[model samples]
Target: MQKVRVLIVDDSALVRKVLTTMLESDPGIEVVGTAADPLIARDKIKLLNPDVLTLDVEMPRMDGLTFLDNLMRLRPMPVVMVSTLTERGADVTLRALELGAVDFFTKPPADLANTFMDHAPEICAKVRLAAGAKPRERAAVSKLDVAPRLSADAVLPLAQTPGTRGGTRIIAIGASTGGTEAIRVVLEAMPPTAPPIVITQHIPAAFSGPFAARMDSCSAMRVMEARDGQPIQAGHAYIAPGSQHLLVMWDGAKHVCRLHDGPPVNRHKPAVDVLFRSMVASVGAATIGVLLTGMGDDGARGLGELKEIGAPTLVQDEASSVVWGMPGAAWKAGAANEMLPLDAIAARLLALAHTPVSAAASRVGT
Candidate 1:
């Protein structure tokens, strides 16, 4: 197999050097060249024709966002953003994702070299994934790999019993890689009176608040980061904080949000499995699980479990996904009741949300 060719663009020489070393540590990836800014990157892109580009959020000649917009409009390709762990960085990185970047990783504010080195596996893994995620209207072609990881049981017990109470239906969604925009598309189409929605999107801790705010601006339902003990309510959507695992717990009379700061499961702090498993225990068959575009099988097992318990589940089809890893895994495992395109997902979800749980179960795969 051919190695993935990469071009590094950063204003700082140290950053460029560190990123090169970090990415090249993987035998599957090769750093073709480095550029100090987007202007130089433009020239290198034409000359080197690298398979993927690792872009810095801030640069000297031209900012990454501007370049990204121009690139997507003119010549679309997979790009991964490298950003700082700050409010501004978080906001900028989110915008980058909107501009068609496949994914992003935050640069530590301090101890740059050591921190970057420590997360080498993740950085290289993202680049490799990006190489296969051909940006505009294409299915991703890569298979992702990582070190062995703990499952949801590492955070919550699998045998926890669910309450037998009947209540309003709930929607639980999970995504990674190109999730930000896919989620925005889904939420924007939802009505203000839609079922209460819970989301777990793999992201850096600092980015979740801004992500929720961004969704709130466009979505009909109020969107906010989940808070511990917050009551689940309709006309609102809760996003899991990037640092903590968000869980739905039966607080006797009602279900409420619970935040767990447990070790990373499936190599993600807010693993989709943790959230899905929690809903299985808290709401049982009353939940509608939706898995969107993401790399890796973080939510596959939990989604299958939901199906086993008679809950309805769906996944984004590969033709519309930025990376098909998660949803494909679930589909292959026969976990999804339906595999729908991104534009069609919200409508199907709304239809299922209104149907009685028993009727929805009967209507599965229809």
Candidate 2:
């Protein structure tokens, strides 16, 4: 097979050299060229036509974000961001993903050559994944300028008449790539009385805290990192902690969150599959599963299991997803009861949660 051609873009010679060496070690990848700035990188991109580009967040001539905006607008391709592991770096990296970056890696501190060495293999793998990734259409920047408003088309209204049976109301959500922003959009639309929400997102350890905090500040529900044994309750959103497995457990009266330090599932510690599986085992027919935009099929089978148990499942439609892999997989598996756009997801969740238990039970039996 032909090797994946890569272009390295960073102002730092050391970073370029180190990254090039590490990436070249993988026989499947080839370093086509290196550029110290976006202007030079632009010229190189036209000439090299590489399969992927590894970009540094900070550059001399043009910042990575500005370069990214231009690149996506003029000629879109897969780009992976290399960023520092600071809080600011996390924020920028998250934005970069939303701006159409395929993936990101946090470089170790200058003092920690050993740490960088330890993560080199992981970085190399991410580069490979980015090379094979599909580039998403750039999001409309105008949406960012204004606070998002809920459109009638964005939500499905709750059933007006009461049914004989109250329905089981559990929520399962999955996110990756541009999940931070997508999650914020859905969570912000929920009311304070929203049903318990379980979210599985792919994020680094240090960033999850800040991500959750940001969600709490913007959304009506209380948001926090998932703690083992914490009861799942209405008006709360539980985020799977970074680098750990978050599964649902039952304590008879209420559902509890459990954290596991087990091996990574589907190449993600807090994999959507792990959480969805636990929900399948614990809540079964009483669950409502949602598969969101992400880069892989991690949650497809678990969502299928939930569907098999008479639970309703939803997938984010491809047009609105940053990456449609996860939701697409669930849809293909026939796991999703509804396939809707991002804006419609919150309303669907609310409508499902509010369904009477008897009606939900009858639907499950059907």
Candidate 3:
């Protein structure tokens, strides 16, 4: 197989060198060139024609976002952002994703040469995934071996009982890689009074609050970071904090959000499986499980469990996904009862939110 060609763009010489070393460490990747700024990067992009571009979120001469906007509008291709783990960095990185970048790698504030190497595998894997992706399409797979991946059972066991027929219907969503933008699209299309929705997206702690804030600004529904013990309510969407696993639990009167700081499940603290399985226990059949675009199979099993207990499950189709890894896995596992494009998912979810659990159960897999 041909190696993935990459172009590194960063204003800092140290960053460019480090990124070059990291990319070259992977046999599957080849760094074709490096650029000191977006202006230089533009020339390199045309000259090198690299399969993928690893761009600094902040660059000299021209800001990264402006270049990204121009690139996507004119000559679209897969781009991954290298971002600092700062408030401004988070905001800019999120905008980069919106502007069509496939994914991002966050740089820690303190360390560069030492700490950054620890994440070498992650960044290289992201580049490989980005190489095959369409512009604005999220990358689909990650092969980082930083830790032994655990299941939702590590945080909370699969609930064996049937879901209680509910007073309030709940919607649970999980995504990674391309999830931030996909979630934005889904939430923006939701009506003001949609069912209570919970989300888990793979992100850094510094970015979660800003992500929630960004979602709230555009979504008709009230969107916020999930707080431990917060009551789940209609017309509101709760996003899992990047540092915690968000679970929905019954509190005798109503359902509430529960945050867990257990070891990362499937190598993600905010594992989609944990949230999906928690809904299996908390709402059972009253839950509507949806798996959007992501890079792994974290939520596939839990979604299957929801289907077993009579919840309606939907997955975003590949044509509309930035990455089809998660939804494709779930579909193969028989977890999803319906597969729809991104544009149609919100409306279908709105319609399914009102479907009786008994009817939903009967219709699934038919």
- What's every prediction's RMSD, in angstroms? 3.3, 10.0, 2.7
Of the two candidates 1 and 3, the one with more favorable lDDT, higher being better, is 1
Pairs that collide in candidate 3 are 138-322, 163-284
Expressed as tens digits, the lDDT of each residue in 279-345 for candidate 1 is 8888887899999999999999999888877789999999999999999999999999999999999
Name the candidate that leads on TM-score: 3
Error of 3 at 19 (Å): 1.0
Instruction: Report the C-alpha displacement of residue 45, candidate 2, in angstroms.
Output: 3.0
Query: Estimated TM-score per prediction?
Result: 0.95, 0.80, 0.96
Q: List lDDT for all candidates, in order.
A: 0.90, 0.79, 0.89
Summing lDDT over every window of 10 consecutive residues in candidate 3, give the lowest-scoring window: 136-145
Q: Which residue pairs collide, candidate 1? A: none
The sequence of per-residue lDDT tens digits that candidate 2 reaches over residues 1-366 is 899999999998878877777778777889999999999999999999999999999888799999998898889999989988788887777778768888888888775444565566567667776776667657601111222332111211222322112234768798886678789889999999899898989988877877888889889999999999998888999999889878877777677899888766676777887787777667766778888887768788778877766677889998887678889988998888789989999998898887764466467525
Residue 5: error of model 2 in Å?
A: 3.7
Determine the C-alpha RMSD for candidate 3 after optimal superposition of all C-alphas: 2.7
| lDDT value, candidate 2, whole model | 0.79
State candidate 1's TM-score. Answer: 0.95
